[model samples]
Target: MAVLVVLLGGASVAARLDDSSSDSAFPGRPDDAASAPLGAPAAGGTASDAYAFIATQKGGSDPVTYDPCAPIHLVVDARTIVDGGMKLLEQALDEVSEASGLQLVVDGLTDDEAPEGDAVTGPDRTWLPVTVTWSDPKASPKLKGDVAGYAGSSSIERDGHRWFVTGTVVLDGPQLKRILDQRGGRAGVRSVMMHELAHLVGLDHVDAAGQLMRPSGDESITTWGAGDRTGLAAVGSGRCIPY
Candidate 1:
């Protein structure tokens, strides 16, 4: 997740009205990339969506906002990695749930088998798919690309009750393999898993250097932030729609 992994207060009355007129672009990368969305918001649009999460804020109970029982499925194959990585992911998920007041139910951990994408047309849709890539630890490169890791989709909007987030978290390559099998490997594993899970729950990088949302250069935020909580509340409340 970016840090403030943002959401789309999707299909508000105004957006639906302008869907035809707006230059629709998909916000995040899609698992079903064959079809470009008609009115999808992109990573750049995340800032705008973050703002929307705020504008649509409706209050909720102190100890309860987003449905605690809502199942947030993890669509990854954790079986391929060391046990430490899997345990770290579980703990990180627990942290996200504790922070957001929402239950992130990881459904079955299936193999990284995504059906061929349909004609990908970016509608306001998110899909969760998982993949695992393997490489030699000794031959693994030292540097990383812009995307330090990979994941499927997490935290999407659809029929009211169905909230799915299935994605990948790199686990098998050389450097990663060594790190996972190393002494006190939990640090690396936890950070990586926690970061990805953050995305699963809807967080985007923040300018605050130390926040989990901020990418590269530095690290901070062992827990969620105000924006994180607000986003969670917005999604959990199902308040994306105008009442």
Candidate 2:
């Protein structure tokens, strides 16, 4: 298994962004066919636009992705959500879901805090629901500087195929507050959420200036760009895993 972390920095702030991946040993498991895909990708973008995947299957071009047949269960930490934040979060997720054709169900709010590191499994070794939470530098060292958010998923390789099981998205509480206070700040906040959620589903930062998946955030670009849509469609249309 391997865990991939994608970092997103504040749009106005100059910050370095990078992707990191770490390997873990897990017993191999069998694979089986799954039911039909829950939905199909929404039409968007030409193939020439810029887009990238965070990770790809070894020796293959297919991006590691979540199962299309299963709903991606999500839980939010209510303690960190700002005023009106929950509505914005829901809206952002809806956009991602529509673009990717993946069903994302918000299980509900949780008392649990964000994990300090990338371990998708709990102490009992079961996969955790995709977690959305807010944290500060004191709590998460990774959000220390201009970093606005972080998102990633852990995947297990089974019979030469890889599928994302679970992931996390952590936003900077204080920085988000500042963003919310700015003109058109609500849109800005939603853009950040959408960007991080995009990362959660396997989209990577592109060098294109206008795209939401660009390395740095931009309050003005509230919606997905052409390449962003294309990538979302690719990831959301992945093979269904019945494991």
Q: TM-scores for all candidates?
A: 0.50, 0.83
Root mean square deviation (Cα) for candidate 2? 8.1
TM-score of 2: 0.83
lDDT of 1 by residue, 158-202 (tens): 322223333334433434454556554556555555555554444
Residue-wise C-alpha lDDT for candidate 2, range 44-134, written one tens digit per residue: 4565468898878889888888888878889998655677998999999999999999988888988886554546566654456888988
lDDT of each: 0.39, 0.75
Give the backbone clash total of model 1. 32
The stretch of ten residues in a row with the least summed lDDT in candidate 1 is: 5-14
